[model samples]
Target: MKLYSLMTTAVLIASTSAYYVKNQKSETFSLNVTPVDAGTQEECKTCITFAGQTINDLLQFVLQEEVDVCGDLCQIVVDKTGKEALGVICTILCDVVGIKEFINAIQKADLDPIYFCELVPACPINDNGDAHFTSLEVMPKKGPQGEFDISFEYVSNNGTGTGMLAISVDTVDGIPLGDDFLNFAQPAGTYDGTIKLDAKENPDCDPTQGPCETWEPGTYTIHLSVCNGECGSNHPHSAIYDTKTTTFEITQN
Candidate 1:
């Protein structure tokens, strides 16, 4: 009888705790967005004007003073706002000095419950369209243990700017076979490159012994990324214009 009573008590306590946590998560949160300076506001008027009515109103409200928001309502905000408008707002917000404060306020308010990361843009607004890879192909899709050619076509919306292209080959599980190659000061356009799969490249397998000697006999993905401008080790300013994954297979003899 005493054990039964204890179990009932524990159950009641757990239920109460869950209810409290649920209520806490549903609690309202408030954030104070810093006001934009006159010069900054003037500079961003084009973005604001292009944001349309719904996002414009939200932008105005967020730029003013402290506002109360809840996760449920913020989800609605996201549904109503366009991606481009959010990108503009993020750009403007990041340009401001108090961006960290605003981010902190958002965290404290738990607004992320409604996918806040998706609502905020990470990169600055690019008037030019983003770069993209139109097509990627590997010649001799299945090759004996030897060198292969990879060709890819890319389009840069920012005109013919100099950039860096990084390429690497790895197994499906992400085990790198050879060193990553980087090409700098390359113009934005189609590129044809060569990669070798031999004992020297992998050193783990001996392809001379059989078809799968030097490298594993399976499919591998060639990862390629083109970044704008000279990308250093950190590549902070080097925004990725395009990324592509092309697959090639090594067949057994």
Candidate 2:
């Protein structure tokens, strides 16, 4: 009789504790958006860090001062066609809030969830393999060689950096933006550029943000970083940290 009573008491206590814990806890949520041009494989991952256990909680989190939604925190606007939407999205770990409701909000607003990626070296040209910027030009109206010229000036720490820079522009359908610059497509696309800094320019030393010119029109994100060599280094390579991005419209004549 005594043993039976003890067992029953323990069971009841355990069950009650479990129930209380379940009711008190909330699920954690992570969201990311990567905006890619509709036609090309190129994309830019914009990260908006937020944490909440439930959908209502998550929405409250977004409503917070720190969390950024479309147009307010960041603006991903299509300049020509006046189309605005968010791209590249990763929402992992949803507990309570329905994914449908969350997605609907994003689709209605045309906002893409920002995604995250590993920190890759920005430049591979210099001996240090660090990317440097001296200038950038965005021709909202025209580009070099009839291609939208989103060009930049890269400098090295030793005054020498060499590497190929790839410019990827996203059109709604992979077709290059028009030459005359007048046929701006609606729901216009985004352009993300990645510059490969040559290994020769970096050699052994790292570069710092000395000076760089402003970028061209249209939405833009610029990143500059140093490449840590494959082998673990006994030599300390100082990190390359200097980046700035601004958006402006160009009125073509």
Q: Which candidate should be chosen as best, given lDDT against the real structure?
A: 1
Q: What TM-scores do the predictions have?
A: 0.37, 0.20
Worst 10 residues of 2 by lDDT: 1-10
- lDDT (CA) per prediction: 0.39, 0.23
- Encode model 1's per-residue lDDT on 45-118: one tens digit a residue: 22222222234344444656454433322333456654444444444443442455434434432322111221
Per-residue CA lDDT of model 2 for 10-89, tens digit only, reads: 00011110010011111111111222223211211121111111223333334554532433322222222132322112
Q: To one decimal, what is the Cα RMSD in angstroms of model 2 from the true structure?
A: 24.8
What TM-score would candidate 2 get against the native? 0.20
After superposition, the stretches of candidate 2 with alpha carbons farther than 4 Å from their true spots are 1-131, 141-146, 159-253
